[model samples]
Target: MNEENTFETHRPRLFGLSYRLLGSRSDAEDVVQDAWLRWQQADHASIRDPEAWLVTAATRLGIDRLRAARVQRGRYVGPWLPEPAEIDEAPGPDHHAERAEQVSLAFLAVLERLGPEERAAYLLKEAFDYEYAQIAPLLGQSEANCRQMVHRARERVQAARPRFEVEPERHRKLLERFMHAASRGDQTAITALLREDARLVSDGGGKALAVIRPLLGRERIARLFWAAYRRRDPAIEWRMGMVNGEPAILRYRTGKLAAVMVATTDGERIVELLNVANPDKLGAGVTPDPGRASW
Candidate 1:
């Protein structure tokens, strides 16, 4: 196969690696585009493994972007959350249970706590199934050091991992009930669906109106949601769908995408709620008119 075709074959994998590393679709796309440019300029005849080379290049670029992103996020106006990306349910080589879990907002949130190198090491080893020996050269670190980084990253991630696994159907049911209560401004019903220590964070990117800080405790969160829906435009609509392998609610205002909401549950109740209202981050699967009433 020619170099262009070979690069096209591995584009999805490269984008996946970059997206997981940076947690931003725009940055991932830039990284993959830059990798393609590098691939074109290099002497492909001398390279033994094109896929590995492309992956390494994309990963390094993602790491660099992530490092710079941390500084920008620090100055962000409100609580920062990863942009929600729509998941394709079609049967594909990359569609699997493990990949779904790794791409989840809950998982990515935990990854954000780790340093850039640690995040890279963990994703390469756990998500992509890369060996320490293989990852060492990419990170320019000793195999032993890569192992240590993965170990540390794993421990930190495990510490914050979900306490219980809710079946997909049950999770959707719980979210629906929570949304129903919020839509009706039922504080009692909403509070019943939230864990006592539940937290709600909204990301408006300073362009939209949202909570400046995270709302803690079930009562406070319930009240916030109740008040929020009460103030929303009555013409707006809510649609339930999957985002990042989990159930989510998409809000539409005048047939335009307004916000995306995803929650992390502890089997019976929601422990965390993430509301993404940032216009810049609402690109995936969102159109001027979604057409359907609901998913």
Candidate 2:
């Protein structure tokens, strides 16, 4: 039997893989849909390994889209930001859902800094448990080169590992402090929360407003947040939402999201701040929820 339901069983893996590659919920959904479409078009009676085929198909689809995505992004208006990846890790989440959410958000976000091939290499080798030899043909690289790439990427990511892993509750508290600090212009509180070497990056995509360079230093970033909030309409609303499987704030003005901030906390302080203000990269047709904060 072709087993029509077989694909449904693998949907979680496919979704997690796609979301990690593209950093967008909608894009991941699209990638999985395209993979299923390929299955539908295949002759399928003798397909040897459906799981391998689906993974390969979805990975390549994401890469194809990513190439075009990069080109179009160069002409983007104010700042270019990755789409906020939201995941559900509430206490009652399904096992697959919780695991997939963590993989898609925190772990995947770390891969974003690498080149597409490096990112793919690291994800497949580390997360999906693919050996370098198996990963070689995916990018047309030799096994040895693939091994080297994975090795290099791992070193870089490992070097930046924080003092602790962020669980859901702790992650929420970190975001709360950050939003509160930013809202109240509390430099003292902000300093205690942000790492000494913490960096803040924002992508406005030119269509919206944001800071271009990674803001460094306590005073500079402190002023940065203070000014941003001061300029925001007092009536503007802020809601805490799950982004990248961690707690994040989605700032809205009127009905549109002005910013989506993701926080990565170290043992004692937040280490990285990625604020997305790019309208085009806000994950396709999904509307910014006015009631988003309740999450």
Candidate 3:
């Protein structure tokens, strides 16, 4: 295949890798574009594997961006959540269960805790199934060192991972009930749907109204939602959709993106609620139809 066709063929995977590593669509796109420019200027005739070369370039770029982002986010207003990406309605090779799990907001949030090199090693090893030996060269480390990094990153991620695994349908049902309760300002109903220790985080980027810290406990979360409902805008429309392969509520104000709310459930109840209201992070354009009450 020609260089142009080869680059186009691997664009999605490159973007996926970069997005997972950076947790920002814009940054991921920029990394991919940079890789493209590098590719254009390189002597492709001497390269044996274009995919591997592109992946290495993009991943390195993403790692650099992640390091900068960590510092930038420290000054961010309110809790910061990964920007949501809309998955296709029909599952494709790129939107399979494994890929979805890797890109899930919950997974991305946990990933944020790892150092950039550790995160890169973990993603290359676990998400992309790259061997330790293969990852070592990309990260400029020995194979054993790469293994150690992956091991450490795995322990950290597992510790913060969700405790329960709820089926997709059940998760959606729980979200529906939680949304219904929140919409009606039914504190009792909402509290019943949340775990006693459930936490709610909102990211407003200092440009909008959001709690400066995570709201802990079911009571606090329910009260916050109740207050929001009381002051809810009539023009804002809430629709059920999929975000990061899980059920989410997309709130639109007069047809413009307002907020994207995603929940982490443990089959029976929600343990965490992430509300992304930052206008800067809400431009991915993931809109799904308003499905019926029943799945």
lDDT of 2: 0.71
**What are the Cα lDDT values of the candidates?**
0.83, 0.71, 0.84
- In model 1, the Cα lDDT at residue 272 comes to 90
**Model 3 ranges with Cα > 4 A deviation:** 87-99, 287-295
Q: Can you list the residue pairs that collide in candidate 1?
A: none
Candidate 1 lDDT by residue in tens digits, 1-295: 9999999999999988888888877888899999999999999889999998999999888889999999999999998888765633222334333337788876777788999989999999999999998999999999999999999999999897755667777787899898888877899999999999998889999998889998999999888877877787777777666677677777767766778888888779999988889888886644323344543
User: 1-295, model 2: which lDDT tens digit per residue?
Assistant: 4456989988889888777777766778898999999989886777788888888888888887766766776676644555655522232333221324335334555666667788778888877999877788877899999989899988877775443655657667778878888888777888878878887878886667677777886667888777766776776777666555456777767755566787667646787787877765664534334434542
Candidate 1 matches the true fold with a TM-score of 0.92
Q: Which ranges in model 2 have alpha carbons more than 4 Å from their true place?
A: 1-4, 77-79, 87-109, 160-163, 166-168, 283-295
The better-scoring model by lDDT among 1 and 2 is 1
**TM-scores of all predicted structures:** 0.92, 0.81, 0.92
